[model samples]
Target: MAQRGFWIPLSLILVFASFVSLWWPGPNYGTDFRGGTEVEVVFTKAVEAHTVRQTVESLGYQTPDVVQVQDVKSPSHFIIRVQEVSSVTDATKEQLKKALCLTTDAAAAVADEHACPSNARATEVTFSPGGDKISTRYDSTPDLEKIKEQVRSVGGINLRAAADNPQIVNQRDNHVEIQLQSKGDQLMDGLRDKLGADTVPAQPLKVEWVGPKAGKQLRDSARNSVAIAIVFIMLYLAFRFDLRFAPGVVVASVHDAMVIIGVFVVLRKEITVSTIAAVLTIVGYSMNDTVVIYDRIRENLSKHRGKSFWDIINMSVSETLSRTILTAGVTMLSMLAFFVWGTGVIRDFALAVVIGIVAGTYSSIYVAAPLTEWIDKRMTQRLGAKKKRPSGKRRAKAVTGKPAEAK
Candidate 1:
């Protein structure tokens, strides 16, 4: 029981530190929440992150968030994230047009009517005459293969010439389809300049872009999901256990979530949709651990009615400690593998899970159990005090100096 002195203050300190971290610097939202662009490129050969970052910076853009993606199943890959821009610049559009013209000229004379169309608006490109304009409008850059397929379906245009010359590929598109042009094309050019022309032999593996409004919606959805999960968990615990136990479980679950978010903020890790999933997972995990300890406490109360409240709590915790350790330990090992070996989103997810498991275990033992004990003790004291007070009939008799008649 003396350990409560240490555990209580330690929990408070941790909760306080987590709150500070949450508000001071805050979590770094990734492309999913914060409107931005993410490009995943797989190189024919290995490339360094610094080289990639430098190449992106030289292209007159802000410092990019560059990460080297590694996984057992996939080849070496790099994912680059940059703040979103409204559209590619006019200069970039002109440059791309000139490059495309040059490619077309090499294949056929620029004056040749058969030469591939050049200078299509950045949003729409004419792949074949009398064919529908290829709609380039998208949240992100459209895939070249997808574009080719659309063109083939509409006009049966030959893609061999465009495939041979990369410049002929329209990479930019405005929201309204006028011509084919996209920010992705600009990024591709920049990467090619630095990583060697052959590095990006094909289009990037992936491209994602989100506007401000969409990002806000995503951010709100992520937050609402976690909030809703907590509420439901609280309701479930209240129904399954005593109402007094529900608060403790809810508090412990929230504590686990806050601590994980705080660590992410402190480390400046990007929060993505995967992060929301991790937090929800932590909520469920923390609740499970707390429930085990709570069930033991309930059992101990019934089995050892004469024992003091603190003593019963201590006994219950002591009995369940081994089970809690075993469960959390095994789960932690799996999460650890993901944190160490997985890449990108998987690594982030694993890191959150690892932090969460540790926090959840500690809170279930020290925070949740102790809170329930305190609440129960307070309720007992209040009931004891009420019982000691004079009855209303006795008070009336004393005031009137006469015995009250039976109703």
Candidate 2:
């Protein structure tokens, strides 16, 4: 307990260093937090990670991430992720508008189709302001296929169906509602053309996209959830113990989070939804340990009435040491199993949890318990100071040099 004066600040310094590191270089944000396209394809033959990456890069994408999926036999699988591809340009808008407005049903639409709106019959041509939407309420129900063909003819721009997302969304639509999409189809085509047709295949396993707007929302939600969890834990600890103890638990939890993130920063790995889940799990685990030791401290305080707060804290932590070591060791061993065998994100999550376990265990003792004792000691001194202060009128007199109610 006496050495805690040395330990607590050391932890703080370490956390500060981590905070700087996290912001300075920053963490690698995943597709879930940054708008991008992710395509999972099962290659008929083995392909190197760099080879796959180069194939995508040659297509003019900004350094796509190509990761080989493990635990598969025969056909190999790989996931490729790239930044947002299709963007609305002035040329796109003008060309799309021209395609919709200039082309006539007689010239372009399917023969004798009454739904096809000719260029003369088309009355209105309007584009959505501040968004990628072009609505054309026709004189009649326009031939959507003809319009699609016209837009498709506008070459140089890589565009795919709103429906053909990654593996063709199973939704039946009129193809009227149009929005910019990630070029998943183009990427698959590129892969097939560059590599072999047998290797790349027609349909990939899956394709998913996260737009910039959606990514921002997910990022904000993740940050808010983490904050909410920490605040609630602090509130629960305060109700369970007291203000002094509650702050210690909260600080210790933050300490553990910093350390876990620091481990990732050092390893130069990406922070994904899985990583966030692991972090939340670690917070709960560390909170449980701190709560256990604090409950013991409270019990000892009541039973050993003559002992100092510092002494009780030391005794309480000493008693829980066996439980802490055994619990942490067993939990860490399980995490190690996952780290060894689990692939990709699973491996990342396991490694994160393992780091948390070690950090959390140390924090329960050196950080949470010692700080709780320190806060109690300071609060006790403040209350004693209040007791030693003079009566109200005497205090007023001492402050103002004179008092109306002078005794």
Best by TM-score: 2
TM-scores for all predictions: 0.74, 0.80
What is the C-alpha local distance difference test score of each model? Answer: 0.72, 0.77
Off by over 4 Å in 1: 44-48, 70-77, 85-179, 199-201, 391-407
Q: On residues 209-324, what C-alpha lDDT tens digit does candidate 2 reach at each position?
A: 77777788888887787789999999998898889989998899899998988879878777878888888999999999999999999999899999988889889999999999
Per-residue CA lDDT of candidate 1, range 5-118, in tens?
898787777778988876688778888898877888887776777887888999877968888877556455888888854453445344433323333233353354232333
Residue ranges of candidate 2 with Cα displaced over 4 Å: 2-6, 68-77, 85-94, 101-148, 157-182, 392-407
- Predictions: Cα RMSD each: 9.2, 5.3
lDDT of 2 at 159: 41
Candidate 2, residue 20: lDDT? 91
**Which candidate number maximizes lDDT?**
2
